[model samples]
Target: MSEDKSNRVVSGRVVSNAMDRTISVLVERRVKHPLYGKFLRRSMKLHAHDADNACNPGDWVRVEQCRPLSKTKCWRLVEIVEKAR
Candidate 1:
């Protein structure tokens, strides 16, 4: 089988790195409210596999969809977009 390079990628901030080889990322998106038509922020917490455990809380990272590595990990860290300031 061929690996799909077009997997979905999401950019978010690392929220937690307590778990071994795993990190929690908080992805946020702005969407317009259907009724009020006002843009509102929506965020989701996703578990991602960080093989090197190099990510830290508050760091921006890009995660790509991948085969499930664990119960809650279906995404893997692609790269560290920005280091924590």
Candidate 2:
């Protein structure tokens, strides 16, 4: 099947990779506060499908939105941007 190029993509660090073929990614973004107009850091944890279980904790990776692979997983591993240092 052809992959969707318009799918959302995010870069983050892999926080957990204990699951069989899944990894938890922590995506952080800075947003300005509505009232104060001060930029603040915010983060979210996303479950991404790792078909080969190639990701490990601390790895920087890119994930792309995809069809749901499980109850909480709708993202797929795209590439490892940087390895754990």
Tell me the lDDT of model 2 at 62: 98
lDDT of 2 at 4: 55
Q: How do the residues 1-85 of candidate 1 rate in per-residue lDDT, one tens digit apiece?
A: 9985789999999999999999999999999999999999999999999999999999999999999998889999999999998
As for candidate 1, its clashing pairs are none
The deviation in Å at residue 67 for candidate 2 is 0.5
What TM-score goes with each of the models?
0.92, 0.91
- lDDT values for all models: 0.97, 0.96
Q: Each candidate's root-mean-square deviation in Å? A: 1.9, 2.8
lDDT of 2 at 68: 89
Clashes of each: 0, 0
- Who wins the TM-score comparison? 1
Scored by Cα lDDT, where does model 2 land?
0.96
